[model samples]
Target chain A: MKMRMLLVAAAAILYSSSSLLMAEADGKWLARVPDEDKARVNPLAGQAKAAAAGKIIFEENCARCHGVDANGLHNRPSLRSERVRHATDGQLAWMLRNGNPYKGMPPWNSLPEQQRWQVITYLRTLPPAGAAGGKP
Target chain B: MFASPAFARVLSWAAVFLLPVPLLRAQEKPYFVTYSTDLEEPGNLEIALKGLTASPKDANAFFSPTMELEYGATAWWTTEVYAQGQATDNDSTVFTGFRFENRFRPLPREYFVTPVLYVEYESVSRADKSILEVTGHDGISSFQVNNSQSHPIVEHSLESKLILSSNFKGWNVSENFIAEKNLSNEPWEFGYSLGAARPLTLVASSQRCTFCLQNFDAGAELYGGLGTRYSFGLAQTSQYAGPVFDFRTPAGVTYSFSPQFGLNDNSIGTLWRFKISYEVQQIRDLFKSPSKRNAQ
Candidate 1:
C-alpha cells in the first residue's frame, strides 16, 4: 500500500511539472461577455468608501499577476490599461466572475458579490488610461 | 520511477524542504472538518501543517501532527497527500500513516448550491488517532488501547464524500455525506459533516493590517459517524461540534484553530486543532506569478 501511494504521489508530482500554463488567447475575449453582463451598472458607483475597500481586495488577490500598481506584469494585462479603463462595470464583473482560465486567470467566483463590486469601485478610482494607478 | 523505497521516501521528504507559497484557501475556508466548493486555484500548491490534541477521559491524551500537500491538478480538480504521526502522553509515539485525497467539482460556474465529489485512500493502523473524521460506530473506548499493542492491525480503507456547498452574499455553507469501506471484510460505514463560515467583515480596509477584522474568519462545524451497513444509524457512534476560526496575514500565511466538544458518550471529551498553511505558485517554465521564482 505504501508503495502504491508513493507511485500515486510521484505521478501527481510529474504531472504538475509537465502541466502547461495559461496560453494567451486572442485579445478578443471582450466579445465573449454577454450583453446583459455588459449593461449591468456598478451598485457601488461613485462611492469612495467602496473604492477604498476594493483597493485592499485588489492588493490581496490581484497584485501578484496584475502588479501592485495594477499595471501589466510580465505578460499579464494591466488592469489599468486602456481596455480596463473603457470597460463597463458589468464587463469587469463578468471577467472577475469567469476568469479567462484558458489564458491563466482563475475565476474569482470564490469572492463574494459585494467584494467583487468593491473591487470594481476601486478600479473606477484609478487614473483614466495609460497611468500607473490611482496612487501618486 | 524511483529505483528504491529509500529514494521514494527521500523525494517525498524533499518536497517539504522546498518552501515559499501563499494559501489561497485560507481566504475562503475557516472550517477544518467540512469542505466547501472552493478548490485550489489551478497551478497553485498549498502546504499545511496541522496538529490535533485529543483528550479522552479514560485514555491517555495524544497529539497527532499532520502534514498536507494540496495541489491544484486543474481548476476543477484538487488533490492532496497527508502524512501523520501521533505522540501520546506517558506512552509511545507512532507514525500513524498517510492519506491521499482528491476532490472534483462538476460545475464550472458557481450556483445556488455547488456539489463536489471527494474520494480518499488511507493506509493506516488501529493505533492511528488522527481523528480526521469519525466513521462507522467509532467510539472513545476503542481509543484507550495501548499504541504498542494496537499497531499490528493495519487497516486499508477507501472513503468517499458527496460535498454540497454554497456561497451567498458573503457566507459559505457546506455539507458532506461520507461512506467508507475497508478493503478486507469491513462493511460500508457512513458519516457526515457540516460547516458554515464568513469573514468578520465583507469589506476590506484600504490599509494592510494583520489584526484587521476583515482578515479573520469564524465559523462552526458538526461531524459524526453513523453505524455499519447492517446497523446504519447514529447509535453507538461518535459526534462532535466545534467552533472554527482562522486568521490570514498580509504575507500569504494563514493560522486556524478549532476546539471541538464531543456530543455523546461514544465521543472523546475534547479535541483541539491548530493549522498553518502557505501556498506555492506551481505554474513555471511557461508562466510564473511575480514572485521570487528566478531564484529557484
Candidate 2:
C-alpha cells in the first residue's frame, strides 16, 4: 500500500509538469510566428481565391456592420492590423470555435473548418495598416 | 432617376412658391448679396456668389480643379508658380503668378493663431479678354497695353485662421479669423467669425439636420442657415449667384433658395439679391469605373 501511494504521487507530479511544459511550448510557438516572418513573408499568398470564398461568408454573416472590405463603419476595429496579421492559423481557428465572452466577438463554431479557413484567408489579404487606394 | 412624377410636381410647386418666401425672410439667414455694375471687380465676389447660389450637393461634388507649378532654388526658400481658375455662369478667370510664402511656425498647430507670410506676383486676367475689351472699352489689349489700367496685382498678405471644435452632448462651436494687408498700399482688413451648430432632435436615424449661426466682423454681419447632409444618396445643388437658404428633404435631396440684403460698401443703400440652388449627390456612380493606372 505504501508503494502504491508513492507511485500515484509521482505520476501526478509528472502529469502536471508535462502540462506546464506544453503550455510554455505553445506560448513559445506563438511568439516565434510573430517575430519571425512578419516583415518578410507575404501574408496574402493564397488570399485571392480564399477571399473570393470568404466574400460569400462575409456577406452572409458579417456584412451588417463590417461593410464589404471588413472596414467597419461604426465602432469596430478594422481587420487590417498587426493584431490580425500576427494571429496564427490555430489561434484564429480556436477563436472561431470558442467565442470571447468579454468582447462581442461571437462564437462561430457552427461554421465548417473549410469556411472558417476561407474567412481567415480573406482577412489575411487586408493591408495591415492604412486605407486602400479606392476604398469607398 | 428616382424622382417620382407626383414628387417632381410637388417640388416644382414648392420651388415656385417658396422662392419668394426666402427674399421676404432674408434677415433670418447667414448670407449677404452684393451686385457689380462692373464685372471685373477686384474681389472674389463672382466666385463667392456662384458658390453661395450653387446647390450644396453639387457644390461639394465639383472638384474645383486647380494646378500649381513651383520651383525652389534654395533649401529654405524658392519661387512658386500658382494658377487657379473656376468656371461658373458660363464665365471664368485665371489668376496666374508667383508667390514667396515663408514657412515659419513656432509650433506646427500654432499656425492656427499666427499669420502666414506670403509675397506674391500675380497676373489676373479675364477668361474672355476680347469680349471684355469689346464690351467694356476699346483698344484694351490683353497683356501689354493694359499695363497701366490692368497691371499685375501684387499682394503681400499675412493670413491667420483658427477653428476650434468640440461637442457637448449635441452642440458644436467654431470660430474663424481672417486678416490681410495690401503690401503696396498698406490697406489692412480683419474679420472675426463665431458660429454654432447643433441637432434639433434626438431621433435615432441616419439623417441629420444642422443649423448654424455666424456673426462676422464683430457683429457687423450676421448669418443663420440650416443644412442637412444625407447618407447613401445624391443631392445636387444648382450653381447660381446670390444668397442661399438651403434645406434637405427626407429622401436625401437638398434644395436652397436665398434672398440677400446688405449695406453697400459706400454705405449708401442696402443691396437686395435673389439666388436658388439644387443639391444633387451620388451622380458619379452612374459613370463607369476608371482604369486604376497611376499617372506618371
Off by over 4 Å in 2: A1-69, A72-136, B1-49, B52-158, B185-187, B199-260, B263-296
**Considering only chain A, what is the TM-score of each predicted structure?**
0.79, 0.57
Question: A1-136 in candidate 2: lDDT tens per residue?
Answer: 9559847754453344223222211222234333333333323347566666666556545543345566543333455545656776666555554333123233343344455666777677666455563233
Write out the backbone clash pairs for model 1: B21-B279, B21-B280, B22-B279, B23-B279
lDDT per residue (tens digit) for residues A1-136 in model 1: 9689879876765465335333443457688888998999988888988888898888777775666777645455667767788888998898888666556566687687878999999887777544453423
* Candidate whose DockQ is highest: 1
Q: How accurate is candidate 2 locally (lDDT)?
A: 0.31
List, residue by residue over B1-296, the lDDT tens digit for candidate 1.
23344334433554564354544434558888788878876666788877787768889877777888887766677889999877776676678788999987776555678788999999888888888877899889878999888887888999999999877777889999999999998899999999999888877776667799888889999999988899999999999999999998877788899999999989998899888887765443234344633321
TM-score for each model = 0.83, 0.29
> Candidate 1 at B127: error in angstroms?
1.6
